[model samples]
Target chain A: MRINRRRYLTQKVAKILIWMAALSTMGVMALIVLQVLSEGIPVLSPRFFLESPRSMGREGGIFSTIIGTIALTVVAIVVATPLGVGTAIFLGEYTREGRISRVIRFGIGCLAGVPSIIFGLFGFVFFVIYLNMGWSILSGGLALAAMILPTIICTAEEALKAIPYSFREVSYSLGGTKWETVTRAILPNAMPGIFTGIILGVCRSIEETAVVILTAGSSLIIPTSLFSPVRTMSVHFYILAREGISMEMAYGTGAALILLVLFVNIVANWRLNRYIRKRA
Target chain B: MSAIPSSPLKAEVKKLNFYYNLVQALNDVNLPIAEKRITALIGPSGCGKTTYLRCFNRMHDLYPGNRYEGEIILYPDQLNIISPKVDPIEVRMRISMVFQKPNPFPKTVFENVAYGLRVRGEARRNLLEEKVEKALKQAALWEEVKDRIHDLAFNLSGGQQQRLCIARALATNPEILLFDEPTSALDPTATSKIEELIMQLKKEVTIIIVTHNMQQAARVSDYTAFMYLGEIIEFDKTDKVFTHPSIRLTEEYITGRFG
Candidate 1:
């Protein structure tokens, strides 16, 4: 068969455009990686990763900030996962295509679109002040949970919906109840998708500065309890850079942040692939 | 296990009428499914054979807006399966179904077979193992899958997956089994295996099969019901239905004159 010259030329142009679009994204990522490496590599040292901040983050390391970052993220995820997964199941399975479900879905969509700064204000007022938690990790975690709930719920619901209706029919015909079918078949199948949502939420928590600064105080001291005020890595990096206290420390924190992101992406992709392979 | 069929009628259908919203799918379906025997419902596509088969276990209850006006009275218990008072879950437990396409759960073979028992609160490892093995054997898939029972159900071929589904249904020890065009997707070899298994399975449980293949019904079924446009046109012994049908429509259908 002979190809039409005009159509072939059009197809060639479209292919080139697609290639250009894809390369542009890759080029931007490479540029950012190069810029961060040049600025951050010099300041990143053993002491920067080990010792507590001293003299307003100019003299010592950011070990306390690292611990605080992980602690708050862990708390956020622990609280959010169950709430998000339950909400997803309720929305996707029990009550699909109805007035209440539509309203809940709309609410979730709105929540996801809200700006990070507004979430910070909400955490500061509702969690820190109103709840009297006094700028602690608990308050920050609670706020972060609320912020990431929409992402988790949406992804989890998508996962649940992806499962074929035939599976559910088989379960029912086997004398399984709704709860039994969900726990045994639906949840296990949807775990990888749910984990992807959690990984994204974790990534968000890691990079977040405003919410942490407002709800979790930027203290140099390492936190002893959930009540104690502490600074996350993002907030510490933000404060150092904003106050012109230490550019070196800020770059080092940025480098660490980049590495954490790389680690998370690698792990998430690996875990997801493993699960998909197992399912197949 | 009752080797001898105590009564001719295992389940008596009286004034069975089914509707999908305003559209009536089955109209006044009345038939007696024999005890410990295979009763095949044969008809063309959209002839209400599959729809009538679904009503046996109340499979239509899964979706909303599906209405049933009937009494499917199970013998001995005499429970009206379609009644508002009786739970559909309990009815399904006593009567399980195997679908057209193989739909094995995304779990191990053992887990898939053990699921029915586990759902009923059978947690003891020995009991589950015993029942799972028994069901697999009954489905004639034990030798093929015994060594690899721990493997995922999807790892099996299409026919094996269908057998696994059958094993899963059989594991629950349902008194009645409904096979809805079960061999429609199978190759001749797999189809023959399943047909033989169905005949053997009738000794343990009453079997109601819906098939388009006239030869399959003739081979396996004790009785045959020919349906057309949501109504039974003929119901008689398999030999009589194939050799000398009472209705012209049934004779035309059986002789390949037209659907």
Candidate 2:
């Protein structure tokens, strides 16, 4: 086939435009990361992480914030992983193409697409007021778990679906029951996919501010129990910015949050890549 | 080649039918598989060869709504193999299948062959080791893989993986072994090796193989059953089926006139 001069020129221009669009997106992300680190690194001191929250210009640490973030995230993962994975298993294995599965899938898709602000509002009204677990880690963690559940379920379902049927057949050919095949070959083979979802869930939970603000409360001290007041790193960053704290301190906390997010992405992407390679 | 026992046990299927939803995969299939004979089911794609082969071990029953009607008597008086009250697991223990594509679990080579035995609660370490070695040797892979038994099964070549699967099946001590196009995914050299192994294996256990490869069927099988659409067109000694077939469809399929 021969290319016309006009068509060739148009194609060349289109390709250049596409490349420019891709490169510009990457460039923006790089600039933001660099800007945050450069401006915030100067304010990052050991005392910033060790001391308790206090008034403007005074030394304070994020120990309570860090502990609360960890506590809430752990609880969220504990609640979400099983429910999400079990739902995925049912969708992928037990449920054939049917109306109920389709409806459930639609519900999950909608949940995933729902904005973070909406989840926060729901948590604030339902868990905080209706359920009367106001500003509690339990409420915050449950809300975060609900927020990330769809993501976990969908990713896990895809992973399970990717496993070859022959693996199940081999297990069954060895006289293993359906449950045995799932727990043994199916789950093990799909572990990397499940792990990827978990990593994404953890990353989202750690960065979530709106949901934590409403359900977890902004108390500076560490929470004594699940029902006690709590504050996470993201909420802390927001409070630091709005409470007339130094811009340097707010930027520093922002940079730390960015690093944690970056670290989670790197680890999750590496694991996902390794899993794909092993399967290949 | 091992002389068919003076009075060998027979595997019988009586007016069996298989349906996948509205479509019939197998229709009114009736045959007796002589003990220790290599019976090859030769047909084109979607002709129910694999479907019929899966019935020997009740492998198809696991998939929902893939129903089988009628009796598949492994030794007679065993009741219908597809009966809901009967556990397919027990049926599988006596009849194992090797798939078209070699599928080795993501485990060490030694563990691959020892899986079936271990699942049966045969826990004696020495016995397990002996069985693994014996099964691998029987599959013609022991000498090559003995030193690297700890290596991951995925690291092996496709042919080695297929042989490993064969070894795994052998470890189960099944009365019958089913192969659904065992060499269809292998290269010519690998295909020949598997053919040779099948020829050897038939001496120890009854085998029902489904293959599109007429040459392989000619080379490995003792009895050949030619199927078309959803019916068995012809079943006879391999030589008769290939050289002097009873039905025109069987002759045409074997002679490459048409599928």
Candidate 3:
């Protein structure tokens, strides 16, 4: 009876600890959301969103910043999606488990761990100095693309791996060539997972600040072309907050970024789930 | 027991042995698969009947760590299907396979049947539609799925999925079809439906089925080969194999003495 009581007490204690842990994690995120809302909600207005900033961002809006963010993300996706997905397919399908595949996998793993600032420095040197691109959207996009490539490749490979081997067997048994099998059976089924990776890359590129600041020259002027200097919302926010330009606008930018990510994640996750269900 | 009519040769497997690296999976296997007939390969689990069936299409070549010896000679030219000179893809085109579990490509029902046709250079839309319809009808699934042809293959029930896989195999009109325990994962009604389909299908394509169910072997097959420990113990008409097995081991297995 005593032992049973002791066991029950231990179980209750463990349950309480689990609840506390979950609540604490939620509490921290809630605190961040609340903080951002408190600091930024009053600053949100049509003018704040639609008008260009003036007097070194002490007034006006982030219209140019929004355009810059969109352009940079588009360029990043254009650069990264094909390259990352191709590498993933090659790793997952085209090659056998050997020294070369192992080395490539190890390199990707290391790349994933590398600091984003290092990518910033590399972009600054390779694009700004060597190539003389000089702080353009193209330079920033390329650096961000490099930053997200490892993650996309890793996720895409895992998604490809998740497909049942039986799919390939069925394709081959029906006389599908390796290429036919990939396109018809393996790749089609792997689409949702691949999309998830691409979406993740987009989110990463959208939020990245250091790479944007270093490679994409900070300009208050709206970018006219890929070669022109641009500034992302994240870089704008960082400058506004750290340089004491405008805390109100900075917090507003933070709120917008958070909402954008949340909206994207919810929509993408729903679509992905639906697609998987339809296939399954 | 029903008498099996005499049929011409379809495939001739001679002294074929298979290895997965150092371990031998098949040993000196010799069997003749007759044309337009259902030949059932019956044995306990791990008896290598599925392994032998896969050899007909050279499905063994897909993965590494697998090795083959001797020859599987198909009809007409009696070409050794296992030779490196003969493309494995071409071999699979002539000889198709259906696995134990139903594996329908995650596409529309129409597309699933059309996949085999598409792979072999059938690109004309009207022709593809007609062939897909014919194959689905041949699989005995058309009546049930005809209305929703564009629905995803995954929407079908398990039995329907298995039949769709059969239709996928039949789409290219292969000379031979290898079924690796095709109905093992199905219910009794679905199993009977597939068995009936197999019997009906023998009027065209030659059938080689690997089965663990003795009753299934008895019902659908014209010829039954009992395998044990990687070697075929008896190969004879289904009636003879079941009613009067020559080998004690086969008799023992059929009589429920041991697997």
Q: Highest TM-score, which number?
A: 1
DockQ of 1: 0.80
User: Model 2 TM-score?
Assistant: 0.92
Give a tens-digit lDDT track for model 1, residues A77-161: 9999999999999987788588999999999999999988888899999989998998898998888888899999999999999
Q: List candidate 2 stretches off by more than 4 Å.
A: A1-3, A56-58, A129-132, A268-280, B1-7, B118-127
In candidate 3, how many Å is residue A33 off?
Answer: 1.8
Off by over 4 Å in 1: A1-3, B1-7
- Each prediction's whole-model lDDT (CA): 0.90, 0.86, 0.91
Winning candidate number (DockQ): 1
Query: By DockQ thresholds, what CAPRI class is model 1?
Result: high
Model 1 residue A51 CA deviation (Å) reads 1.1
Ordering by TM-score: 1, 3, 2
Number of the top lDDT candidate: 3
lDDT of 1 by residue, B1-259 (tens): 0122335778988889999999999999888878998989999889999889889888898888999998999987899999978888899899999999999988899999998899899999999999999999999999999999999998998889999999999999998999999999999999999999999999999999999999999999998899999998888888888998878888999999997
TM-score of chain A of each: 0.95, 0.90, 0.95
TM-score of each: 0.97, 0.92, 0.96
Deviation in Å, model 3, residue A135 alpha carbon:
0.8
lDDT preference between candidates 1 and 3, better one: 3
DockQ-better candidate, 2 vs 3: 3
